[model samples]
Target: MLSSLAAGFGLGLSLIVAIGAQNLFVLRQGVRREHVLSVVAVCAVSDAVLIALGVSGIGAVVTAVPWLLDVVRWAGAAFLVGYGMLAARRALRPTGAALHVETEAPPAERGGRTMVATTTRTAAVLTCLALTWLNPHVYLDTVFLLGSVAATHGAERGVFGVGAAAASLVWFAALGYGARFLGRWLDSPGAWRVLDGVIALVMWGLAFSLVLPVFTG
Candidate 1:
């Protein structure tokens, strides 16, 4: 049991530690300190649910329906491409910090113009959901691959799944909360531009990943 648990935890961390679109989005939100908790919660919970489903043998059912995977692949690619374009636009026009949370000051102290960030709490959460759920690779990795591994554990699959879920919780919590420490360096618009550019690249890369295999195969 302990060996399977350790194996699950290690594998889960290895799979999720990649520099992907979802991780980039979480890091950006963490740096901005906007809806970090909600974003982290959504990511961790979504992973947990998927891992549970995989361990429960539902992955077999999902893979049995190849058409559903096709739908998810196309939708996920479209969403990623759209998001990547939006991020690229932001990068091209680098702006100052978007102050979503403002302090109430006197009219004289405060400028008449609202210096709000383009992203809202609702939008941030929706984006988080899309990034988590709309990625077909996520299902392939978390559900199908992990499920197959868990099945090898026989009766210990439940414990293995729990360990994997714990890894997700730990990783997201660390990433989402730890990103604020990078604020000192990203204070300038130039830094933000670079970050946004990288995010755009990550998003487009994920989109291409979804599309490439279909054409290649």
Candidate 2:
């Protein structure tokens, strides 16, 4: 049981600690100090739910319906491309105070621009959900791959799932909270532009990778 728990924790962390859209979004929110708790909760809870489903044998059902993944693949690609364009626009023409830390100043004091300071909680939460759910890779990694590995534990599969879920919570908490330290360095609009530019490239690259398999396969 101990071995199974350790294995699950190690594997889960390894799989999740990669550079991806979800992690990027979380990092941005963390740096901005905007809805950090909500974003982290959504991501962690969503991962736990998916891991539960996967450990419960839902992976087999997903495999049986091959078309499900195909549909998700296209949708994910489209969403990523759209988001990439937005990021690119931000990179090319960032607002002067866009990356400034939020303050209690009124809109008039802040040049009568509220949107430049921070996004709505609803928007942030929705974007977080979309980033997590729309990506087919999440399903593949959490539901299929992780599930398969958990299955090898036999009767201890439940423990393994618990360990995996725990890892997700730990990782997201650390990432979302720790990113605020970088906020000082990203104070300048130029820095934001560079960051957004990299985000745009990564988003487009991931989108292309998602659809490339369709063409090749």
Candidate 3:
């Protein structure tokens, strides 16, 4: 049981440790200190739900629907590409003030910057939801792959799922909160540009990967 728990935790951590859209968004929000708690909660909860579904054998049913995966693949690819373009634009023309702000400032003092600085809680939460649910990779990794692996654990699979969910909580909490350390450095517009550039790359790269599988398969 101990071994199975460890294995599940390890597997879950390894899968999520990769640089992906969700991780990047968490880091971005963290740097800006905008809706950090909500974003973290949404991501962790989403992962827990997906992991539960996988362990419940819903993944098999999901994979059986090839057309569904195909549709999600294209939709996800389109969303990523559009978002990547926006990130690339931000990289090209970034304003540090627009990306960062201390909430203590009065709205009038914030001026036009207020509009940019105030990434509404609604927008942030919705974006977080879209990123979590729209990414086909999330489904593949959490549902199909993880679910299939959990099946191998037989009676101990529930324990494995618990361990995996715990890992998700730990990772997101660390990432969403720990990003503040870099906030000072990213105070410079140049640093934000660099970060945005990297985000654009990751988004487009994942988008391409999603599309490639369709053509290749």
The most accurate candidate by lDDT is 2
CA deviation > 4 Å runs, candidate 3? 95-118
Error of model 1, residue 103, in angstroms: 16
Give the whole-model CA lDDT for all candidates, comma-separated: 0.85, 0.87, 0.85
For candidate 2, what is the lDDT? Answer: 0.87
Candidate 2 residue-wise lDDT, 1-217, digit = tens: 9998888889889989999999999998888777889999999999999999999989999999999999988888898898899989988977556555435544334435443545788998998998899899999999999999999999999889888998999999999989978967886788888888998999999999999998898
> How do the residues 1-217 of candidate 3 rate in per-residue lDDT, one tens digit apiece?
9887888899999999889999999999887777899999999999999999999999878767889988888888898898899899999976536444444655344334642454688988998888889898998888878888999999999889888888898999899889877756875678888988999999999999988966887
Candidate 3's displacement at residue 189, Å, is: 1.0
Q: For model 3, what is the alpha-carbon lDDT of residue 15? A: 91
In candidate 1, list every pair of residues with a backbone clash: none
Residues 1-217, model 1: lDDT tens digits: 9988988898888889989878999998887777889999999999999999999999989878998988999999999999999999989986655333223533222345444456788999899999889999899889988888999999999889988988888999899989877867876678788888988888888899898989998
The TM-score values for the models, in the order shown, are 0.90, 0.92, 0.89
Clashes in candidate 2: how many? Answer: 0
Backbone clash numbers for all candidates listed: 0, 0, 0
Candidate achieving higher TM-score, 2 or 3:
2
